[model samples]
Target: MPLFGRKKSEDPSALRWSREPLPPTPEPGPDGLRSMEDHRDYLLSCLTELPPFSQHLLDALDLSICEDVYSAIDMPRFDNSAMDGYAVRAVDVAAASAEHPVSLPVVGEVAAGQDALDRLSPGTAIKIMTGAPLPPAADAIVPYENTDRGASDVRVFAPSVVSQHVRYVGEDIRAGSQLFAAGAQLGPRDVGLLAAIGRDTVLVRPRPRVAVVSTGSELVEPGQELGHAHQIYDSNSTMLAAAAKAAGAQVYRVGLVSDDPESVLQVISDQLVRADLILSTGGVSQGDYDVVKAVLPQLGETDFTAVAMQPGKPQGFGLIGDDRVPMIMLPGNPVSAFVSFEAFVRPAIRKLMGVTPYTRPVVRCRATHDFGSAPGKRQLARGIVSLDADGGRLVELAGGHGSHLLGDLARANAIIVLGEDVTQVATGDDVDVWLLDEVS
Candidate 1:
């Protein structure tokens, strides 16, 4: 019989001995707080190398090539005119000037896109348009203003220099050379360059697929009425999707899940099959209804929990399901979720997406207020950045530092990072800040 069914006399210590001691709680490292550096280092360690996949050339990819040199073939590809005037040999207008003008026969006209059949004779000129390839015999182009044109002849009042206003072959790009190098993100100019080189496709890194899930029964989708109590609008999914897209990932908004272990497990199980990375918000904390923390162990092992950061302290990371897709669990608070994503999730996504290291540009600036924090934890404060009197950058803290203050987050353009062991910082104190906006 089982110990619970057996009589106490049969096995007094059986019940007590059968019970297992609670697993020892993980001790927080260094002052009982995990610093930002610790969180970063831990995340970097968990990333596994992903297999390469073939993607279409036209796909919206963030290219990793930085330099590319393209060659030009028959640059201009033909002899054309360069000015909206006339093409002639320099010797033809050698002695022509305002005081002693020279007149010659303009036997034919050549516009850009049209070829000139009549070649220039020794003393003749041809009317040409801007961008028209220079004729083979022409060595200079005189502006229309410097010449007077008749029905079949033209008069020149200003002498032109050799090769003046003429676009030479292979001047812009030679026939053969290295086009774009590795690590360059193709943009409009790159597209034009590729087109110029007669290339319709290019090799690029495939975008990483990211699945976003927002957890919480209290979260109500927009356009739906929220119950009178304990209900909040679902913003994490949209926000995370947009952020992931901006970070060059193909975002699959997986919608919201209730705070139920079964539902959370189902969502992760479904997403793990398709996503390279799974990002979920809420349920990682040790709350009574925190289903994620419970389900994570059942589905996969937790990588780490409870990063030592304010507003985003309840965070977790782990693999999901048998597919082993990396998953990040962020807190339910809107600001907390956003901050956690930026601090931990974004870097991993960037790394997998082929973004260069040190992509987030940091700047040293002065704090405009006396911001204070606990000595043991790292704090990321939202602030507005501006240039100081001496042209140095300064960050001003936004009001309302609470984790749930979405309005403050909306107004913030920078994040002031206070490292561990630092308690208080007075105004004008030098600080390290990540600029959220372009500083002119």
Candidate 2:
């Protein structure tokens, strides 16, 4: 099956998404310590791709089409001139060249989009502009560079062949022909082509609405002055909101909520009207102040699982409110939250939007330094990946592997993955890298 479109029942692993989601993935081991793939797949299985809608061309950027499209009219519409010169019978210019130029009276003029003038007689010519309808009985054109351009009369300096510089009807696209198959994603060029084929709107999956919230009594807005040394500004909501936006989601960044269970539950409940997906940062760990993990149980069927991954092991997933809007609870620490988003949330958002291959591109590269990993957990280390002198990819760890190091996460352009059971890796060893940003 093609790896990338529709009818919600289809599988994205083989192709693209639809309005409904794929089947439930297998559960984790008896201990409930989920692997990265199991956690991600479970979240994906809980979602339904946003339903299709008839959206105008200007508003449908980056959306996948829900159905095939057929053109109603021919692309050229008629035989037209492809050059600004003269249109005449090919036989008329066959013997004409620079040395023996043929002079003919210019009976009329036709600019682009204008109706053709009277039919051409045996040896006469019709001056025409690029895209102008070819005159009746005229089968060829001589470019302005190949002739002495004239208004009343024209001189052909070179021979012209039949159909030269002429755009025939339906040459580019035929009427009633298939223009796009079901599940084609729209880019700028695709939009232009749809417009050229006379489409005002197309049925496609809508961008998912995602709500991002951060919870903690110690967390304050970025601009606020801190009252105590222990207090810290919340950055997870901002980062995750921006990330969701970049992934083509409609984001509602509910910046900060107190750690109280009632407040957390109320805020999350209010978001269900607009959110298709929800992301809450902090309060999933075993700490006494972890209210999100505590309050979410009252909202819907919520699960707090220890995912076997470094920096982001504590994870929570829930179907909140009566609508069952899916929610993911991330680690409060900056790096862990970001890494969890890359592994789980980004694909979920893309799947909801029905986009293909809803995951970051992974490439194999050599590590520039040595690193160690937990014996039974996956590690996503921040790193800077670059091309070597010979164009081979090489990566060096950006900052020490600390979950709280936000500065290093900002500097890195890729995630260096260390799988479970990989106790240590030596310098120059091959590693799989997930590209996070464009490499120049």
Candidate 3:
């Protein structure tokens, strides 16, 4: 019952998804065609607020904080030595020099995680290891290199500066101060900080649950024998599922569905309870066997449209079911699905989890090859962006501009965004490229 309500159409012709005379494409928006940014905004508008955070351990990476987190105690917690050295009084080592060395009795030895209960007597020193607590009454640290590096007794050959190599309490962060602001997505460094402050768990936004399904009768699973003529392997669902996971969403791959309209409806109905977002590939296109197009409209509120982008033009999105989960329909081509996920779905996933700066970092680089673009359509062409010998950033095309070019998608590390007004990019032209992966 949670997946059944939808405003029924009075006319029977409005429900058809047959290839006979495919539904008329919506008129292009005023800016020539629906710009990539416009389509993204529309998708975001339909997606409602995600649930708040639950307590998550520090080891859970890529989770965003739901509220500000303040430390209960100061960072470092106590004064400690920054290096292996001799803790001594500043005055005792003041006149010591390499030519005329001063010797002091080693009163104690302090190692990390051990308390230093012994106070330094005048003219004596304590041998300290790195991260060891400084002895009481010791105001300076003389490095081993400046001394004889002895355990019984140490020699001071240089004047030690006051508080040298000493990490004071509250130096990094003060007690009760805000450690991380609300909406902060924890990284490795952040995890270290939280662990250093003795936090076992912190409140974090729940990762969005995504259900991915591929719809096409011509699809076959990889590793299986493809005896049927022209049967393509089901790569779209796998690619989208991985992309969703990489974007910090929990993914449930529903596998490949045939062109049976009734079965497509059933699969979507079953997945409604588990999915915050539903993603389907193949069946939204203008084809006779596009079962998702035929079946989705009856299930809930949805839309099928053409976006003015190369490769991933045919787009579908809308809210559906009692929970109003957002569903995005993508093209079956491997390259198109990948590009659309990077440009659109990735940002949506990040936004839902309250991640700041959700979009991939963009940089302007000198084009090393000419790239042709479609007229009146924005193009996201795959490219290899890297730095040259002279430290200048350069970008070159990765593969041919075809939606089915899976090899190109695999080799691409960046996307060269070409605007509708631009037709071609010549060598040495500055083009904006969105980084696809981490680059040194």
Each model's TM-score?
A: 0.85, 0.90, 0.90
Better of 1 and 3 by TM-score: 3
C-alpha RMSD (angstroms) for model 2: 6.9
Candidate 1 TM-score to native: 0.85
- Per candidate, the number of residue pairs that clash is 23, 4, 0
Error (Å) of candidate 2 at residue 129 is 1.7
Report the lDDT tens digits of candidate 3 across residue range 1-440.
12234433343223332222222334567754677877877777665546564555653578887778888898778888888899999999999999999999998899999998588899999999988988899988998889998778888899988998899989989999998888778898888888888887887767888899998888899899997688988888988999899889989999988888777877777677678788888877888887777778766677777788987988887565555567888888889888888877888888777786868877999999777788788899999888889888899999899999998889999998888889988989999899887654
Candidate 1: minimum summed lDDT over ten consecutive residues — where?
1-10
Per-residue lDDT of 79-149 in model 2, one digit per residue for the tens?
A: 99988889899898898888899888888889987888888998988889999999999999989998888
lDDT of each: 0.74, 0.85, 0.81
**If both were scored by lDDT, which would come out higher, candidate 2 or candidate 3?**
2
Number of the predicted model whose lDDT against the real structure is largest: 2
User: Per-residue lDDT for 315 in model 3?
Assistant: 84
Predicted structure 3, TM vs. truth: 0.90
Candidate 1 wrong stretches, greater than 4 Å: 1-28, 48-58, 65-82, 94-101, 115-118, 148-151, 388-391
